[model samples]
Target chain A: MHTLTDAALVGVVLASFLALGTSRLTSCIRATAIQGWLLALLSVAIHEWPPTGHTFFIAAVSLVMKGILIPILLERAIRQASVRREVEPFIGYASSLVLGGILVVTAFGIAGRLPLPHQTSSTLLVPTALSTLMIGLLLLVSRTKALNQVVGYLVAENGIFIFGMSLTREVPLLIEAGILLDVFVGVFVMGIVMYQINQEFDRLDTRNLNLLKD
Target chain B: MLRLLVLAPAAAGALAFLLRANAHRLALLVAVALLHAGLVLGTWTALPPADLDGHLALDALGQLFLTLLSVLFVPVSAYACAYLSHDTGRPNRTFVGCLLFFLSAMTLVTLSQSLGLLWVAVEATTLASAPLIYHHRSPRALEATWKYLVICSVGIALALLGTFFLAMAASDPRSGATPLLLPELVLLARAHALSIPWLRGGFVLLLIGYGTKMGLAPLHTWLPDAHSEAPSPASALLSGALLNCAFLGILRVLHVCVAADQAAFAQDLLVVLGLGSMGVAAAFILKQPDYKRMLAYSSVEHMGILALGVGLGGAGVFGALFHAVNHSLTKALLFLAAGNLLLAYQSKSVSDVTGALRRLPLTGVLFLAGFFAITGTPPFGMFLSEFTILSVAATHGRYLVATLYVGFLAMVFIGMGNIVLRMVQGDAPAPAASGHGPPSSHAPSPAAASRESWFLTAPPCCLAAAALLLGVWMPPGVHAALDRAVAAVAG
Candidate 1:
């Protein structure tokens, strides 16, 4: 169970890298959805067999929303806006890959310094989670497309969701569900904004959103 | 009572969404605002019980913010009614609904007692106000909304991570898991030694996260655009009520920090960020071309003052609470007045708008007065609060901070005055000469049309008056509430 959880966490990190390297927007979204599903799978793997209560509930919802629902919303937005498939990132893919590598090293270094309250058998979980978070932020900053930013946001949210799994017993079911609902609504709203941006600008590149200023 | 306070606006928001008649929708907005205010005020005599297993409660701090939100909403809602009447180009169903929903989310932010619940409420507020900011449906409004949503969503997501860290900090393996409740965390901080590194890390992340939402400096890049582009009434609420909700999140985290004996770290960060915000606002406000953007920068400056006051941690905290109310009233008044100016001048640029006093007498006067009130002039509540914060800083021998505080305040005053004075004083430029085109130039001033209806003018006048009244005399009940709230935060 512990090795499986570690492998799943590694899979999550790999998915983030996949997202970082991909120029195709749809493939990036796919990587994030796969990352989300890996997160859901880890919960079940960690708890071992018939997870119940908050664990099962969080896993089920994470699987559906992060895995299935959010990607569907983003894909629909992609179609509706007819946005270009290529990311046309502000930071080139090679450099982003290098940055992601540095972030992963830093995540491990920082994770080693912090003491966890409850020890987990999977040593890679904390570092992987932090790395995922940094990559998400990287994606947000380095991407020009609005939909890609939403993808970055979901990836960042997935990082936090993984972090929360450590405290699954402490955080209430209501709070966890509320967090999921907030993210779902957040993406849903972003999708709507993307549609509006397309209607107004005839393009989805947020680089052109520089109209308002001092 | 708690349910009434939160759910009333929500129900009205849904109702406003379905109502086809604009008049009925406006009436319902005013009615719900009054009812929500009444419920909040009714609980003043006696506190309401915490619902949702202690997840929701009106603590002293909550009461202070709840009162601010309710009080500010009344006038802003009234202003919205008249403001909506002029712009017949777009249907206001989403605009009105989003405003009410914004109010509901802010109410929950004040009421939420648990960190997790508070995160949810704050995130909900970001979602709710995005539509309100985009009410104009122009490309500019769309840009503002998209920025507001993506940036705020990212910021609030960091806040969730901070929340998780906070929970982790409190949890001890030997004791099993502790619930992520503010009061409980405070108790844990007092009784058991918490993991200090995690606690400190949590506070830092939470500050950055919530600071972004609260429009603190360095993180406040999205604020001026969002506030300037949104409809004036929506800007009023965003400035008046929504920022306070974000501040509430930080105050809760500060509460736990105070209990954990990690306050020095938190306070130092607050002071630095607070001063940083003030300096940033001062820099931007200087010769700012747009009047509404000027007001938005002013909001950032005042948020800095709030953080600085609380960080100073004495009469400074009390003054911070007082300053929060004063800022809300005066800032909302100024934004609403700016809204009217937007209508009359048909533009937000200072160069394009001159002699506001000549064109729209009442709004112009209120706008000028509001500038004074916001700049901490005497006879206004901001004056008293700013003085209190400064005096406390001086007495505590933080002379350098005190000097910088005064220096920033002075710079901001001159900066804002340079623009606002230019706005209200000169002769009205011929509308065509002002470059707004022939149709708007020949059109009768919106101020002239809105002047007859007290709905447009009265609400802002009353809000400005309330701000002035509080300065001259802080009501005993309000005074007590501020003291209790300060104590709650100061621990």
Candidate 2:
């Protein structure tokens, strides 16, 4: 169980890195989906005993929303907006990889200092969560495409979901469901807005939104 | 009663979609606003039982904000009736529905006691208000809506992460579980030395999250665009009422930090961010060409003042509480007046709008008066609160904060005053005076005479009067309520 958790956690972190390195929007979305699936797997893997009904349900919801539903939304947005497949990040891909490495080291360093409530099934959980979060933020800052930024937001949210899973017992099922519903509606709204932006500007680049500055 | 407060506007929102006539739909909006206000008064006067599950309840802080929302909505909704009647380009079904839904989401933000529930409510407000911002459906409004949605959604997502981190901090090995409810977490933090690092970390993320919502600087990129592009009534709601709901979210997190005895860390962060926001607002307002964007920048400045007051602790918290109410009334008045100016002038650019005082006397006077009140001038409610915060900052030996606070107030006053003075003092052009300008097709008269109606002008004038009234007098009941609210944060 412990080894499976570690392997899955390591895969999640790699998926984040994959997201950062990829230039294709579809590929970035795919990497995020894989990360989401890994997270759901880790959810059941980390439980000591047979997973309860609550964990099982959370895992199922996570699979559907983060893995399937959100990707479908992003794909539809990309198609409707007619955005280029290229991520066309603000920062170069090579620099992002180097910066991503530093983020991993920083994540581990920070995670090392803050003690968890109890020993977890996988020691790598906190570091992976932190790294994924930082990578998501990095994607947001470095990427110029509005669609890519939305993907970055999803990736960041997935990181937080992993962190929440670290304390699986503390979070109520109702709260978890509420969080998922919010994410769905939030993305839905963003998707609608992105399509509108496409209609107005004929481009998905948010840098063109600079018209309103002081 | 709490449940009703949260659900009633939602029902009204759905009903608005089904109602066709703009007149009847607007009447529903006003009726619901009045009903919500009445329900709030009923609950406050009677002190009814709270929701049993602890999911929803109104403490003193919540009570104050709820009262503000209900009161502010009455005028804003009233103004909306006249404002929407003038626009014939598109139907207002979605606008009316979203307005009431926005109110419901804001009420939920105030009433929610659980951190998770608050996050959900705040996110709901973003979704509800986005359509209202896009009411114009022009490219500009669409762009504003897109930025508002994406930026706020990203910011709120961080807040959720912060909420989870806060929950993690409260998790105990022995108990194996902990609830994310605010009061319960406060108790737990007090009983056990819940992880300070996690709490502090979560608080910072939350500050960034809700701070974006509150239009704090650096994260306030979407505010000017959205506020300036949206219709005047919608802008009034965003500036006057919506910002306060986000502030309430941050206040709840501060409660937990206070309980955890890590308040100094939180206060320092707030003070830095507050001062930074003011500085940013001053820099932008000095040269802002758009009249509506100028008002939006003022919102940023006042949000800074509120944050600075809360950061100062004792008297500052009280001042912040007082300032929150004052800014809401005064800013709403200014935005609504700006809306009228937009309609009469048909252009938001300050260069195109001159001699508002000559053309629209009532709105012009209220706009000037609102500028005075918002800039912390004496004899206005904000003046009293700003003075209180300054004196407290000095007494606490936060001389630097106090100095910067005064300095920014002066800078903002001069900057905003220059544009406002220019706009109000000049003469209207022939085209604008004859109502031949664009968007004037909806106006009935082509005379230079002020086209001001009781509906369009009265709401803002009354709101401005309320600001002045609060400045001179603080009823005992309100004073007591503010004290309780301060205790909630400062304790």
Candidate 3:
């Protein structure tokens, strides 16, 4: 179980790096979706064998919402918006990948110093979660396309979910459901707004969204 | 009963989306607003039982904010009726539906006792109000909505992480799981059962998260754009009710911090952010071109003061609560009146509007008075609250903070005075051709512009009267409630 959880956590980190390295918007979305699936797996693997109904329910919701529903929403947004590449990202993909690597190392360093009250199934969980969160924020700021930013947001949420898996017992199932529901609705709202941006601005580039300055 | 306050508006909102006629939707909006307000009033007389196994309950702090939200929605609903009536071009279904959902979400924010639940409710507000900000459907409004949505969602996502961290902080290997309930966490903190580093880190994240929603400086990038671009009634609700709900979120965390003896740590951060917001507002307000944007910056400024007041942590907390009430009434008044001016001028530019007093007498007077009230001029409730905060700073010998507080307030007053005085005092501008300004399909006819409907004028009048009444006489009931709320936080 520990080894499986470690592999899933590492997979989540690799998926985030893949998201950063790719300029193709669909590829980026797919990477995040993979990261989401890995997180859902971690949610279950962090628990003992034959996970309880509540654990299964949470893992199922995370798998369906994070891995499946949100990615589909983004893909449709991409098809409608008709933009494929991230095209002239504020920070180039190579540099973003380098920054992503640095973020992972930094996450390990920071996680070492932090204390947790309860034991975790794997030591990699905290660093992986932190790295994913930082990479997501890096993608969010470095990308020019609004769709890419949404992808970044999803990655960051995935990172948070990994962190949350450790606290599965402490947090009530109802609150977890509410949190998942909010993320779904938030992404749904963003997809609708992206459609409007395409209709109004004729492009999804956030650089064009600069009209409302000081 | 607590559940009803949230669910009623949510159900009404769904019904609003289905209702075809604009008149029926507007009537339904007014009815729901009144109903929500009636329920909130009932809570003041007899506090409701906690629902969801104590996850949802109204404490003094929540009750104060809930009441404020309920009261503000009444006038805003009336104003929206009048405001939307003139513009029939766009469908009102989304606008009406979203407004009710916004109400429901805000009600939930006030009632939520679980940190996780509060985080969800606050995030829900961001999603619900995003569409409302895009109601104009102009490119700029679209820009504002996108910025509001993306920035707030990311900020809220951090808050979710913070909530998880807080749960971790409360967790104990010796004991079983600890639910993220506020009262339980406070008890744990008091017992020293929580991890301090985790608690501190979690508080900071929650502060930044909710502070983003509350329009605190540095994190307040989305506020001015959304407030300036959104329709008047929506802006009023956003400024008046929504910011307070976010502040309530922070106060809840701060409540736990106080119990943990981490008050100074949290309060120090509040003071820094509060001062930074004021300075940002002062700089922007001094040269603002758009009147609505200027009002938006002033909100940033007031949000700063509220933060600073709570950071001061004694009588200052009381002042912050009082100021929250005053700021809501006054800001709502200003935004609603600004809407009236927008109708008359068909522009938000300070240069485009002149002699508003002559164009719309009641709205102009209210607008001018609201400026004074918000600037902390004498005989307004804001003045008293601002004075209390200032005096608290002085007595604490925090002369630098006190000086900066007065200086920022003075700078804001002068900056707003220049723009507002110019707009109100000059001869009326010739009604420009409607196409000259931003493309607003809802621009009223010249006749409608000149004639101020009782619908639009009366709401601001009532708000202004409330501000004035509170300034002079704090009803004993409200005073007691404010004291109880202050105790909840400052103790």
Candidate 4:
């Protein structure tokens, strides 16, 4: 079980890198979907065999919503917007990959110094979560397309979910469900707004969204 | 009873989405608003028991915010009814439904007794209000909605991590307490059973996360745009009610910090952010071109003042609580009046509308009064609260904070005075003098546009009177409630 959890954690990190290096919007969306599936697997792998109903419920919901449902929504958005490549990223793909690599190193260094109250099954959990979070933030700031930014937000959310699931054992089932519901609705709302933007501006680049300012 | 306060509106909001007639939807919105207000008032006399095993309860602090939210909704709903009648370019089904859901979510924020539940409720407010901000369907409205949704969602994601850290801090083997329950965590923290490093880290993340929603500087990029672009009634609720709900989240975290003897560290960070927000607001207000945007910045400034007062502690906390009430009343009044001006003149530019007093007498007077009240001028409730914070700062010998506080207040007053006086005192433009502007898609007909209805003017008039009354006298019950709320934090 411990070895499986460690492999899933590593898979999460590699998926984030794939997302950062890709310029095709569809490829970026696929990378996030793969990360979501890995997160769902980690949810079950971190627990004992024949996991309890609570853990099983969370895993099933996340797998279906994050891995399957949200990807369909993003594909529809891009299909309607009719724009593919990331055209003009603020930071080029090559440099973003390098920065993502540096972020992983820093995450390991910081995780080594921090103290946790409880022992986890794997030592790699905290560092992997931290690295994923940093890379998500990097994608958010370096990308110009609205669709890319939404992908960045999902990556960041998945990172937080890993940290919460591993670190705290006492979180209630209801609160976890509420958190998942909020993220689903948040993405749904953002997709609708992206469609409207595509209709009004005839493009998905957020650079054109510069009308109101001080 | 507490469940009723939250669930009733949510169910009604769903029902509203299915209704087709505009009048029936409007009636449902106003009916829910009145019913929520009455339920809240009943709590003042007979407080409800904690429901869901203490996850939902109304403490002194919760009661204060819930009351403020309920009271403010009444006038805003009435104003929306009047305002929507004049401009009928689009269907308002989504607008009405989202407003009720927004109310339900904010009420949950007030009543939530566990940290995890509080985070859920606050995030829900962001999702609910996104559609409200995009009601106009214009390109600019869509831009503001997108910014509001993305920035707030990312900031809130960080807060979720912070909540986990706090749970980790509370999970000591010796304590055996539930992780995120407020009462249990506060008791554990006071006993020094929690980890200090984890507690401090969690508090900082929570501040940034919730502070982003609260419109603190450096994270307030989406506030002005969302506020100015949304229709007037939604703007009023966003400024008056929604911001306070975010502040309540921070205050809940601050309550736990106080019990852990970490108040000094938390207070210092709040004061810096508070002062920085004020400085940013002062700079932008000095040459603001749009009046609605000017009011939006003023909300930022008042939020800063609330943060500063709470950061000062003791008497300052009391002042901050009082200021929260005054700011809500005055800001809502100003936004509604601004809505009137937008309808009459068909512009938000400061240079576009002049001699408002001659054109629309009632709305013009209320606008001027709201300006004075919001700027902390005399005989307004804000003056009393601002003075309380200033005196406490001086007595504590924090001369730098005190000087900066006064300086920002003066700059805001000057900036607003110039723009407002010009708009209110000059002669009416030739086109406006005849009670009309150029016919546009959204603007009302020439005859109905300029004539101020009783529905439009009465709500703001009532708000202005409430602000004035609060300035002069505090009823005994309210005074006691304020003191209890202050003790809940200062202890």
Prediction RMSDs, each to the true structure: 1.9, 2.2, 1.2, 1.3
Summarize candidate 3's per-residue lDDT along B345-455 as a digit string, tens digits: 888999888898987888889999999999999899999999999999999999999999999999999999999999998788666653475555555766778799999
Question: What is candidate 1's local distance difference test score?
Answer: 0.88
Candidates 1 and 3 compared: the better one by TM-score is 3
Fnat of candidates, each listed: 0.83, 0.66, 0.77, 0.74
Tens-digit per-residue lDDT, A1-214, candidate 3: 9889888888888888888999899999999889868877877788888888888898899889989999999999999989999889999988998999899999999999999776787888899999999999999999999999998998998889888877746478878899999999999999999999899889998888989978
lDDT of 1 at A206: 93
Off by over 4 Å in 4: B174-176, B432-439
Query: Model 2, B358-427: lDDT tens per residue?
Result: 8898889999998899998879988999999999999999888888989999999999999999999978
lDDT: worst 10-residue window of model 2 chain B: B440-449
Complex DockQ per candidate: 0.78, 0.62, 0.78, 0.78
Q: Which residue pairs show backbone clashes in model 2?
A: B355-B426
Better of 1 and 4 by TM-score: 4
Model 2, range A73-128, lDDT digits (tens) per residue?
A: 88888988766565567889899999999999999999998878777667898899
Residue B306 displacement in candidate 3 (angstroms): 0.5
Q: Model 1 over residues B1-491: C-alpha lDDT tens digits?
A: 78778888998899999999878888998898999889988888899998988898999999999999999999898888888886443678898888888888899999999999999999999999999888878889898899899888899888889998988888766665445888889999887567888888888888888999999999998899999989999999999999999999999999899988888889999999999999999999999998899999999999999999999987998999899999999999999899888776667889888888887899889999999999999999999999999999999999999999999999999999999899899898875565445354234444543354577789999998999999899899889888899989988
